[model samples]
Target: MLTKMGKKGSSCIIFSIMLISSFFSISISSEQMIDDYRGFSDSNNSFANFTSAGSSTVAISGEPAHVGDEMIASILVSNVGSNNGVANLIIENLEDGISHSGSPVEISPGSSREVKAPITSQEQGSVSYRWWISSNGSHVNASLSGEFSVEVLPRQTISTYLESYDWSPSEGLVLDASLFLSSGASRPLLLDIFISKDDGPLNHLQEYTIEMDPGRRNLQIFLGNPSADSVFVELSPIEWSPNPTSLNYSTLTVNSPSADPSLLDIECTVSSLEPTSGESVRMKVNLTNNDNFQSPSGKLRIVLSSDQSILAESVIPPINPGVSVSYEMVIQSWPDSEIVQLEIIWSSEESSSSVFLSVQSSVRDDGFALPFDISSALLGALSGIVIVLTGRLVWRATSSRTPSTSESGIRKTRIEREEHSANVQTREIDCPFCEQRLSIPAEHDGNARCPSCSMQFNVAKMGETTSSIDEKPEAIENEIPMSFSTDDILECPGCDQTLRVPIEKRPVQSRCPVCKLEFLAEKG
Candidate 1:
């Protein structure tokens, strides 16, 4: 009996090794995997085999799928070994380039239950995975390979301008994107998505992932706070694929309507009275969302200026979807002087939406101011009136005149005396530079500064100062010098005596010969 038992045991050992080589490490199609078989046949030494049994994973969700969205994949592994030891299963490698981070464990003798792993990663692509099943120690083992791909789609596209919307964004804003399948296909595509907020006190939202089918889809995005900031934002949807496959993506952003706050359909106005030159006189601004997206609750910020200055601002908060909101504010019109953009910022508890509003500035009417300015017509009327008055005075003087020899002689003498007086006065005019009333000898010699204001005036060759800048002094003097004389007076600081210099031999002031004090020469 002992001999017989030994023979049977040896035979069994040989059979086990052969069976393990053929069945323990077998590969097959996805449909062939069974919950009871553990995807392979078990030998006497075989530890675990998987059997497909449990809730399957869902794929192909749309864009803007909420945060923490889950994608679960499940399979069961059982121990076919005779021992009643614990069977530990671990994901050693994944197929389609998928990386699994979680461990699913089970004990075995007969069979272990199904295990599900919740996959979370922003990485897009095919999820390829394989697992190692050890029944007792590391001695008996088995493995199964599986592959699944996920796809994310693009967001819907809007026109360049809001056709008939109520509120318009000050800046064009893009929204978060939706997921899609290829063909915009279904299931088969993997994606990891991340969302973030920018500028204006908002932090980016959390990260999320999902599986999609195939095809085209939209990703929603939005602008930052309309009143406070103007920033570019991103909502990234990344996808990956295994070898022997290619991926597709959309390069265009989901556009918003042109930002025009005046189109907000609200009653907003500006009346700053003495408005700054560069600032825009903002009026009523309105905004309306055509897609009627799910938006947060907050003041509908309408930027008065593309730079977003708060001028005569009014906030319209809690605007609902499919409804209109209004805002009014004045902005520096000089830089933002043109009707550039209007921003409709809607905020909420979870997320926000920014709509672009196209704008056109208010048309101004300056008809009332025309009369006060120098109009050509006014100058023409004045000229005509002056001609009429002068003609009337000349006619009366000529008609009343009577010829007389004695009167003519007296008039001639008086005229001659008047001419002499005028000449004497002109010659006696003092010089402004020397503080002596003088005639304007020639004209401005060269560029000089007024002693009072230190203002440099370029004296044209015509002897007149350019009146564009400096104002005239209080007292007037028609001072004219026949020639500029630089040799007025001089003294040597080194000595206590004065020296005389000619106009041509004018000595440059250096060390005074009398007192040793240094003096710089003046450009006379």
Candidate 2:
């Protein structure tokens, strides 16, 4: 019993010591959890305590805060904490039509820094914005926020003009301009001047920087000598007061001196100023040289000015000093009235002379009028009648003198009969030696010589075939000569007149002189 009681007591003591150690460990764990929560609360308190030196102030500098004016907003930030901090500015709630620009910065404790942001607005009114400055330290984070407002003014009105301009051979071109401002400006303005010669490209002449009070102001500019027939000047604004509405530009133009007059004189005359339509117009032109020393040669042109058509042109002959020349031209008049120009041009001397003529409208007369001269027409009719009568008389005299029997006519008939008889007795043949065609009497049958080849060959008789020839000779048939006495007579079939023909010229054609009728006088 003593041994058992001692073992039980030792076990109970060991178990009691284990329970106390467990209680101590649980107490230490609860204390550590409380300390951790306190440390977190202290960190949050540090952030809440961060503050600006005296509520960061904002100021606008440079030009006045007007619409289209670029003004700077200087934000003064002071760090009053005990440690250094990094500060970043954020724009939070900016109104419409307003803009700003800036970046982050680092600040030290007890030192103030100015952060500048450029602000501009395209509208006029109360413009407002909210800004926040976030600062970060080694052990804490801090932030400061505020709101700012400014009144933006409206834009100004302006006008400009080019008053006058002058030019000289030695001084070049000088321009005068005027400017009018409706109200005062807070900044300087820039103006540019440009000039163009003879419708050419614009050239920069001068520039002006203006700083003036409200109202009109005058300015003068000088441009060096430029060779041109005409000068054009313009005034353009480069930069002016903020958003000012004004004219774009003003301009002025000036012309150079006139050229000298020509030394040629022209005189022209027209036949009829108001002629009928479709009628021809006659013009006489006379040109004279007015210069006593120069002899000029060129071209003379007549131009229809309404349509610029060249009606007539001629080369002008050289004219001596103080000499004159004349020309005549005829042209069809236009269907309507118009002005025409006559020009004389000399290319060598570069001189010209011109004169204008006005052609009046066509005139019509509603009456009976003769198109030709009355006396000349009567004389022409009389002359035609006399010529016709003379021709008739000559023809009657010639017909009455024709002879009843003409010896020459009989002789001509006899000769024609002989030629016909000769032709009838001949026949064409080809030479065997040279194949040349020849005409010979049909009765001749012997050796014949070829005229072209000078060679002799036998001729074949009529109606006979030759050994050397491939074709038979042509035959003459029904040909017989007639014989008659010297007292033979024949009656003409046309007029019944008796004609005596010679006996040797038998079967001849004989003509009767009474009716000019011909008939054959044969032996039968």
Candidate 3:
């Protein structure tokens, strides 16, 4: 009975201890739960007054950007609530190898701020991208997004070279070239062609604006004569758009042959060495080419050396090797008796040669001399006729004279002689051959001789009535009248001498007495 009572007491004490421990644990758990609730309530109360009012914006700023160039993007954030804001800009979905980013920016209340970022692309094409703006502030937490594109232009390339070149005396210099271009945009490009001689300064030869489609094109340029032995040609670009990656300049060197003197032979001869005044002098100029293979052409100039005046100018045709050509030139002789100096000049593209010659002129005379025998015979004949006529007149006078006893008888004999001389009336007639006037007795009609030309012709009796000295004469008795039609008179063409012909013959072949030229005479 005592052992059972002890065990029961121990059991009762253990129960009491367990109940006390349980009560303390319950109190500690309650305190921990209260602390957690208080912390949750405090966090909820802190954010209870936050409000989102304004918004954020994003955009792409730079468009139509070229390849390898930087593009700009912008982000704008506005804060209209009762708190400040912070904005961040980021570019997304850009082309490969292209990127852009910006740092966060802070904005005050009731204000806005912008953020910008630069993006670079390596290739040419349309670059599509997305822009994002993240705004964080005491009253707002929002994100803005948009899509945009940037057009990237392609780079340009240009190259040029000379294909051929030529030079000539007539055409100067000619150049042929090829131009190549590769571009993705249309723009004006300046092309400059330059030339240099013997390492001299570059001279601008030609300038052209390239505005055609991208391809290969041919160009023909005429640079004229530079007058240089060695020339250098260069082609380069002056102005261009979308700056080219490869703009190669081309150059060429040209060499020319050495200059040579003229190789020509000339010979000249004149028609008369001593020409008279009012005479035409003919000169024959013969040119011979001495060159073995060269064919040359130029001008021939004739100048009077005394006054340095040009007489005649003619073009010299192209003469082949070992060829010859002749030219004839006529000039009037000077009026004075002087020496005429002439200069013949032969000029070519490279050289010139001249020859000097002279001519003499003199005055002309009008008188001519006959042979000695003919002059002597004429003088002797004239003297014999004069002596015979004088002797006859003296004999007749002596035989017919009566012995005069007084001075009155002598006077009567002289008056009878004068009356006998007055009965022989004379008339004037023209010689047909020499047109010289001759006096003959009015009653005489027979063959007569012209004293001037020694030409003999027949004279017919004139039917005219004699008038006494007291009566007034209707016509002069000393002059002979000759009336003929124009058809009866003809002029010799060779010597231009006048001849009287019969009217009965319409056309007659006759010989001129002066020049002895036989020709047909006709009436007009």
Q: State TM-scores per candidate.
A: 0.24, 0.41, 0.29
Q: lDDT by residue for model 3 over 230-346, one digit each (tens)?
A: 433443444433445554566667654222336677777877768776677678998876654333457776666643445556788656556788998776544434677778877
Best by lDDT: 3
Q: Give the winner by TM-score.
A: 2
TM-score, predicted candidate 3 vs. hidden true structure? 0.29
Task: List where candidate 1 sits over 4 angstroms from the true fold.
Answer: 1-75, 80-84, 90-104, 115-132, 136-232, 238-524
In angstroms, the error of model 1 at 209 is 11
Cα lDDT over the full model 3: 0.62
Prediction 2 global C-alpha lDDT = 0.60
Candidate 1 yields a Cα-based lDDT of: 0.41
| Model 1 C-alpha lDDT per residue in residues 409-523, reported as the tens digit of each score | 6445678767744554222222244433433324324444345543333334453434442343333221211222244334343443343333354434333333434444332
Candidate numbers, best TM-score first, in rank order:
2, 3, 1
TM value for model 2: 0.41
Show the lowest summed lDDT stretch of 10 residues, model 1: 156-165
